[model samples]
Target: MARPDEHIHIEWRGGTCRVKWWTGEYLPNGRKRYESKGGFLDEETAMDYGRDQLYEIRHGIHVSNRKGATLMTEWLDDWLAGMDHGHLTERGYRSAVENHIRPYFARKSVADIDVLAYRAFRKHVNGVLGTGSASNVMMVLGMVLDDAVPRLIKTSPVERTKRRGKFTKKKKKERKKDMAPAVVDRLARNAEIFFGFPGYVFMWTMAMTGMRPAELYGLTREYCYPNWPGTDPRPDPDEEERYAEDLERYGLGDDRMPAIRVERQVQYSGGELQFFPPKYESHRTLVVPTFLAEMLDKLLASHTSRWVFPAIQGGSLGAVNFDYRYWRPIADGVAERSGPRVRRPRPAIPAVPTYRGKRLYLLRHGHKAWLDEDGHSKFAVESRMGHEVPGVEGIYSSVTVPMERAIMKSLQARWEKLQQDLRETDS
Candidate 1:
């Protein structure tokens, strides 16, 4: 028999009794709430727990009484729906969920998540997606668990320092290789000749400015000051202020050099392209080499689109299309060595050294290396790269005009030397 006010039941499984009780509560949408306690020696202990659970639930405290029956998939759905994350971040998280997390642990109880289970999951992910993607999947899972702490889950099983897979900080840093100056020249020249104007400007700007791909893709005519101090509209008041005192000392004006104002980046989110601020809100202006400035001025004179580097087919350039269709072929070595190598219909190019598996981002790193070689201040270098310098140096030190001028001078010399080499090669 059961009390009429509260619905309670007892059952036996494998010579053990368990108790289940329906709390006299309903969801806003008219669904009943139920809880259970199990694996007890006898009905007496089970009923005691059942009564305790019912009391807790009735009084509006339900976390303690949760039976860990909530499926990971269900909780993740709720969590993801409520999260206010960036478009790319949300897309990646959803991908991790759909591709790896859901298939392995969606049906499992969150309470059952432990170190051993996470290790097993890591092995599975590594086996299928390899270390890089597996690393991203693990990070997403860790984020979900972190959010679930003391609510849906007891603790996060994924340790940031663990060596389960090859997914570690050191390994990630080790994977990024820098490009040589000659290599960058080759890439830019190949891009200009093979892919035309958009590719030409795109490669040159990325190599010289060290701007992120999203930032480069989002470059608009309005933000580019190809003639800078010599010829431009009203100067940016904030940028002027940042290096004003230094400029006064160096007898320089705001428009002394060509520059690009990096404010927002393009993101493909929610099945549409949207413009937003740079990652970590790193907004700054980058001074360009004189040669690049002249080239960009020429480029701007020809085109009328708001975007400086529009796609080849007349829309926004996507990262995937740019890498596979444009960069990959150039990096894998183009026809540069002889008469009419009819590989892909292009003619009269020489065979160059192939750099297989080299990434486009290495060009940006090469720019950083150049700045480093030129002995620029750490703060200035980091600022130019659109990265926030950590600790006290970032807060105190400022980018001086002399520092900017020095970097500009070095980059200009490099570009001039490259042009001379290209001219000599043509002759």
Candidate 2:
């Protein structure tokens, strides 16, 4: 009931139908490749399999005969070895696979991972890690499955939950955490009192510029341009107009000030501290106020090491070192002093929000907020923060000299106020 050259044949073997098929096309050497996969209880199923194979072969597609019995752990090792992401990204992926995924899915077949299994895995991870960290773990898991493709699995099991621009329940409730400017001022002032100039300069620079902690640690004397009359690397397109308007108040060409070129960031990988490109390759130059420039100069003059904020012994300062030794003590001290209105002497307080369990990155967030409060244009703000503005805005807009002066003036006002407060306190 079939053509003589059908390229497919069915035969009964061991009480089941065995289907054998040839790929329709001849090989480069004028020979055909054949494959056999069978043991169908019904001849119809075997015939159907043969038909699908023929269809795929005619379309010039390589049909995968893989049974997908490869273990998840085995596949992950191979996938990780072939990954081309950055060192930090590679570290994160490896961490997720080893710490979260492998413990449960190691021996399981890669094909067995479905949405249900992933959901259960997500729930387990959420229990042990914070919500954000759990989400990142799931993201890495999804990437792994995506790489498997049709060879290992028919389709990726990790279906995107929603389309872009669509908000979920969590999105509605999520808030941008920040400390008040006054709180930042107090913290910066206290940092100097407790740990001296390094602490003060570090705190104030982070508050003013919104540089990432890694960028702050990566700051070197060479990159700190305390005096530059030339225009910034990313000059705004409307600089001429903005400059004209600012001429009356700020005076043209008087906008030159100190700047820091954010070229690289410090990363802890393979149990060692090293420097790498900033996140999103956001290489930028940040203009700063005069007071901050003076402070930076002072800090640099005081430290013999290349790092603006070197460790006590030497080399780049670690995040753990900064947090435990400097940031935590200052935060704890502030919390202890800022108690209830009751005038009675308070006992040793055990707790405060600890900046709502946020890390040093919050200073960057606070800086962005400060920019927004001062009504700086979004283009300038995003540029300063090393964030790419999406769509037409990013392509069309640029950072201007006028914009820099405006931000500098705004931050300078805050610095003057902070200095006045510190002077009053010291007196």
Candidate 3:
């Protein structure tokens, strides 16, 4: 009988046997491919390695056994081609792959990206792009590796780190997103200076409603009122129309009962504008304070465009277009600009201490904080924020009419107190 080590070659070079064997694969040019392990002291060690390699291949766990060991760049392209995510998500993943990932890891075969190599890449990304971007890039890379498992890679090298003995140094403090009602009022008042009164209303609405920025940007006049004609009559989304309260049938129902439907948001994808349902499709009705409801009524009456918040130049605001011209000045306040663009253009707005250097998205965070402060039910709060609450609590609990009224009442009182404080300051 032929020995199992027949195909394995042993080269004696005055030290040890160099065992080499054919790998049952061919190059693109039809050349036979091989794998070798050199400097084996005994034929037993050499035989064991060759047998293990053969076993892995037969069991379909050998990475190089399939797809001829695809290169990282080629595999990334294949993976991206198969993605069916939303435009924004697609854009981000493509950006990570093209800008950060492909440049560093492209030349390597997918099988060669072992745990050590991937960890080094992680450290490099964190050092170069900072935490937030590194996190997103790593997410894409993890998914890419995971998809190649048992094909181009036997196991994914992505490490899901445990918190034990990690980062011994003191971490940075968590950023506070809690904003008092007065701080919101100040931001709104300054927003009027930079943009128009719409900016003022925009600030208030964002702070109070907790809608995502895109959701608010896509808000139309038709969807802003409690009686907005889209959904059928029902007390709760999961309930029957017979559960609709009598207070809902009449005009302007309860003063504290104005609701806005969160059906869609503005998405700029593929170099064109698009409308998509809210993130995670959390289409919901958000109750607004009576005063905010009144403001929307007036805003709708005067505004000619379909959008509740149109660009300063007209039409729907392109995503991130207003950052330099509108959001920065509104958030950080304009002190001065030293450029040769012209002359004395002092368009200054007082900076709110709470908002300085903070993102506009924090307003959404502040709304959640406010809701928590008011001790509202988690179900009601999560529903208002367009978030899916997890576990059995989410399954059983529902937002009722009383919860909506209570939220509206608290918000109205805050606004009233702010107004009172402002009046007192003037007096």
Candidate 4:
């Protein structure tokens, strides 16, 4: 039996019972508002359960406290502002939020985003932007929701979606392939024309030294001196002789061998060049060959700034600003002209979108390959490149300056041979 005034009633049959709540009758638009109380074996038990649920809802105990009206765009803005600035790279964070995340979900309300809608968004991102980009978007969304879980947001649709697949695996494959030395050289040669000799030097240095872009840009004239006192005191007989020969050959004093001291990096944050410690290995010194030393000296003398590679703008180089304005265009130009060495082709502008093209970060790869081919010990290579070797190997082995100098000499000799080959080809 049901009371007309009471919207909820319980019915039992043998071992099962149903508790039903009649929300209302059909409206003029043929829509119905109905609430349900699930089946239970005992009628009285079902009624009691339904009453408890109703009481919880009335008291706002079980109700979601999240506001349904908050737009995705608003949430994103707050998330970005609240993020740990030190943990996230400025350029990367900006790209993920502005270029990908906001463009996809800005107009949608948080409450309207269900699992199905999220899946559709993921599909759209994958189909149009590619899986990697879509995955990045999902990552950002997940991070935002993770922060919001304890606060205003109750559910995160990003958590429910499938983000990884063949596409992501393929992207990783492409990255590893791009790290080859030959690819780096082609990229460097092409970029040389636009960035000038300094740009070429900058790219090569990064490849060989494994110094971050900002560290390369932050190099100073004082840091490139031959007698850098901070260098490790290990002596190398072969390197000592080679360095002496180079100093004499160039009529340079003991001050000619280029020593690199990394005190800070130039980064663009908040629309300006900001000097900070290098992203990873911020406070270390590296020694380079005389040829690179001379190039750096000339660049420093001409630039007249604390920075080794100053922005064309008014101050020190900022990685993001410099890359966007200078490095990317040069990289694209190089990628267009470079291919397999078996066949030469005329240089042409790339037809692909600038944003969608690939540019190899060659300096680090070139350095590693050159060291490997020249048979320099891995410890020597790691030291010169300022990389911390993994595991017990790093703990037991120490690198001396003499060993570093020997490695540099070998690298320099190879570079000189390459220059001769280039000259012969030109002639």
Which portions of model 1 miss their true places by more than 4 Å?
Answer: 1-62, 65-67, 160-178, 227-255, 334-345, 348-354, 419-427
Per-candidate alpha-carbon RMSD to the true structure: 5.9, 7.5, 4.9, 11.5
Largest lDDT belongs to which candidate? 3
lDDT of model 1 at position 123: 81
Question: Which pairs in model 1 have colliding backbones?
Answer: 229-255, 336-349, 336-350, 336-351, 337-350, 337-351
Deviation (Å) of 334 in candidate 1: 4.6
| Per-residue alpha-carbon lDDT of candidate 4 for residues 1-427, written as tens digits (9 for 90 to 100) | 6553276777776668777654344657887544555559777788777676556545544323234457878888887887665433656776887987788777887666766776777677778776677777777666766666534455566646346544443454443332443444555564555544556567656765667666777665555543343332324465576445434433255543466666667666676657676665436656677667766666656655655555545355554466666656655543445667834344553332322355434455556777777787788777666677898888898766566677679767766776777789799
Prediction 1 TM-score vs. true: 0.76
What lDDT, from 0 to 1, does candidate 2 have? 0.75
Off by over 4 Å in 4: 1-78, 87-91, 98-114, 128-130, 150-169, 175-204, 226-257, 298-303, 310-360, 374-403, 419-427
- Report the lDDT tens digits of candidate 3 across residue range 1-427: 6555665676667778876666778889998787777888988898788877777766777755346467899998899999998767888999999999999987888888998888889889978996778889999999999998877777898988734334634446658856988888888888877657788888899988999988888987767773363333343566545324423532333343677778789888767778887888888878888899888878777678877877776677555576566787887888755567845444568888887887888899999988898899989999899889999999999888888888998999888998899899999
Deviation from native of the Cα of residue 49 in model 4, angstroms = 6.9
- Cα miss at 183, model 4 (Å)? 9.7
Q: What lDDT tens digits, residue by residue, belong to model 2 across residues 181-205? A: 5677666666665556787788888
For candidate 3, what is the lDDT?
A: 0.79
What is the Cα-based TM-score of model 3? 0.83
lDDT (C-alpha, whole model) for all candidates: 0.74, 0.75, 0.79, 0.61
Candidate 4 clashing pairs, residues 3+ apart or interchain: 206-363, 206-364, 207-363, 207-364, 208-363, 208-367
TM-score per candidate:
0.76, 0.78, 0.83, 0.59
Off by over 4 Å in 2: 1-5, 13-16, 23-41, 60-63, 162-178, 227-255, 334-356, 418-427
Model 1 C-alpha lDDT versus the unseen true structure: 0.74
